[model samples]
Target: MKTFTIKDNVKKFLTVLFWILIWQVVSLFTEEILFVSPFKVLPKIFENLGDLNFYQNLLSTVLKVSWGFILGLIAALFLGGLSYRFKVFQELISPLILFLKSVPVVSFIMLAWLFLSPQGIPVLISFIIVVPIVYLNFYEGLSRVDKSYLNMAEVFNVGLWKKVEYIYLPSVRGYLLSAVELSIGMAWKSGLAAEVITFPEFGLGALIYNSKLYLDTVNLFAYTIMAVVSCYILEKGVLYIIRRILK
Candidate 1:
């Protein structure tokens, strides 16, 4: 197993190197006209890594998106539980869920801009993108839970909190985990899109947009790399927290 794992890691590294080689070749041809070489981009990334401002921008975006994610997740679980218990509420909410699912995220950002502060736009957009996904995912999981276990609990007069703790959470754990994983990525994407459009005083998106305005390709790519890396790290961190909580 250890040998296989080492070989797997090597293969992944080689695959990444292959893509970087391709990017370098492409950059050689286009660097004069558009984006710069990976060598330049990499140095820009490191330069930013040493800057206090980069950390502040990253923290700003992370905190905004994290708040949106937590709010959306809590709202989804609460509403989903209510929906599971009441058929009428589910039926009433179906249209709203469908509407949220159907609307383009760009449209949400544009409309939200008219009323919400620039700082609030990303949060709203992220929340909008997250709610339907987690709600529907959790609802499906709840609907498919084993009725026998629930009935047995009811017969024994299990307390509401105990029933949720022992039965519902365990049964829906997989689905909730999957939903959260999926939604956090979307939340980052949408939240950043909001930031780009809104151009709040601070954020990865704001820096990205400012770079574009100044035609600074190196900074643009560097900021983009930061955002992508941040998104990846945030997803892993959220999963770690969820697993610990559920355990």
Candidate 2:
């Protein structure tokens, strides 16, 4: 087990190093203003870590997006449960779900900007981005639940809570996790894009926008890397928490 783990870590490290080398080589030939090298951009991540404004932006974006994700998750579960219970309800919402799935994210952001406050834009956008994924994936999982298990539960006169706890939840766990994993990155990207357009008081997107305004490629690259790292950490951390809770 330990040997396999070590090998996996080494493989991941080598993959990252290989990409960084490619990035470095490309930056060497590109205009410095347009493409900052990883060598220069990476240090800025450390520098930003020490800056108070970085935290403020990070916190604001995190809070806003979290609200979006939580709300969207709750709504998805509720609606998904309803859809699972009633074929009619699923049919009723099918068109709307299809519309959401087909619509460009930018259109949602732009339309939302007109109605939602600057602070609410990211949250709404994130929520919009998350709902369809959660609903569809969760519904699919719910639909595929083993009939034998449900029949056994019925035969045994299992209570609603027990059936949910022992049967339904376990069946849907993979689907729920899959939805969450896919939606996290989209939520962040949409939320941040909304922020870039709306320029909320304190947000990483605001910082990125400012960097663009000043032609600061190093800061832009640093912030982009920060966002990517943050997304990865968020994905892993949330999955860890979910696993622990489920266990």
Candidate 3:
């Protein structure tokens, strides 16, 4: 076990080092102000880390996106349940889900900006991106439930809670987690994109736009890194909480 762990760590370290080396070589060859080295960007990111406004912006964006994600998840679960119980609801909403899936993100951002306050745009965008994903995954999960277990439940006259706990939940766990992971990334991306277009007061998207306007490549890269890291941390944290609860 120790040997395997050590080997895995070594492999990951080597992989990261290889990519860093490639980046360094590319930066050296380009010698462009727009493509600053990773070292330069790292310091800028650290400097920004000290700013109070940075945390405020990060927290605000997180709150908006998280709220949106939660709302969408609940709606999806409710709607998916309804769809599972009734063929009529499923047929009615199928086209709407398809339309949401087909529409462009920028179009949604633009349309939402016209109707929603700047602060609301991110939440709306996050919801738009997350809903269809959760709906589809949950619907599939419901459809894939073992008929044998359902039949057994019916035969035994299982209560709603028991059926949910022992049958539906266990069957849907994988789908729920998978949808959540995918939606986390999508929510962040769509939310930030909406913020950038709307120029929300305190958002990572606004920071990135400002950086670009001034041609601050280092800060641009730093903000991009921060956004990616934030998304990753949120995704892992949510997944951990879900796993703990389910366990």
Can you write out model 1's per-residue Cα lDDT over 26-59, one digit (the tens) per residue? 9878844385888888999999999999899889
The regions of model 2 sitting more than 4 angstroms off are: none
76-192: candidate 3 lDDT, tens digit per residue: 899899999999999999998998889999999889878899999999889988899999999999999999999999999999989888999898889989999999899999998
Total backbone clashes of candidate 1, pairs 3 or more residues apart or in separate chains: 0
Worst 10 residues of 3 by lDDT: 29-38
Question: Which residue segments of model 3 deviate by more than 4 Å?
Answer: none
lDDT-best of 1 and 3: 1
Top candidate, metric lDDT? 1
TM-score of each: 0.96, 0.96, 0.96
lDDT of each: 0.92, 0.90, 0.90
On lDDT, the stronger of 1 and 2 is 1
Model 1 regions more than 4 Å off:
none
How well does model 1 score by local distance difference test?
0.92
lDDT of 2: 0.90
Model 1 lDDT-worst window of ten? 28-37
Q: Please, what are the lDDT tens digits per residue for candidate 2 over residues 119-182? A: 8999999998889999999999899889999999999999999988888889889998999888
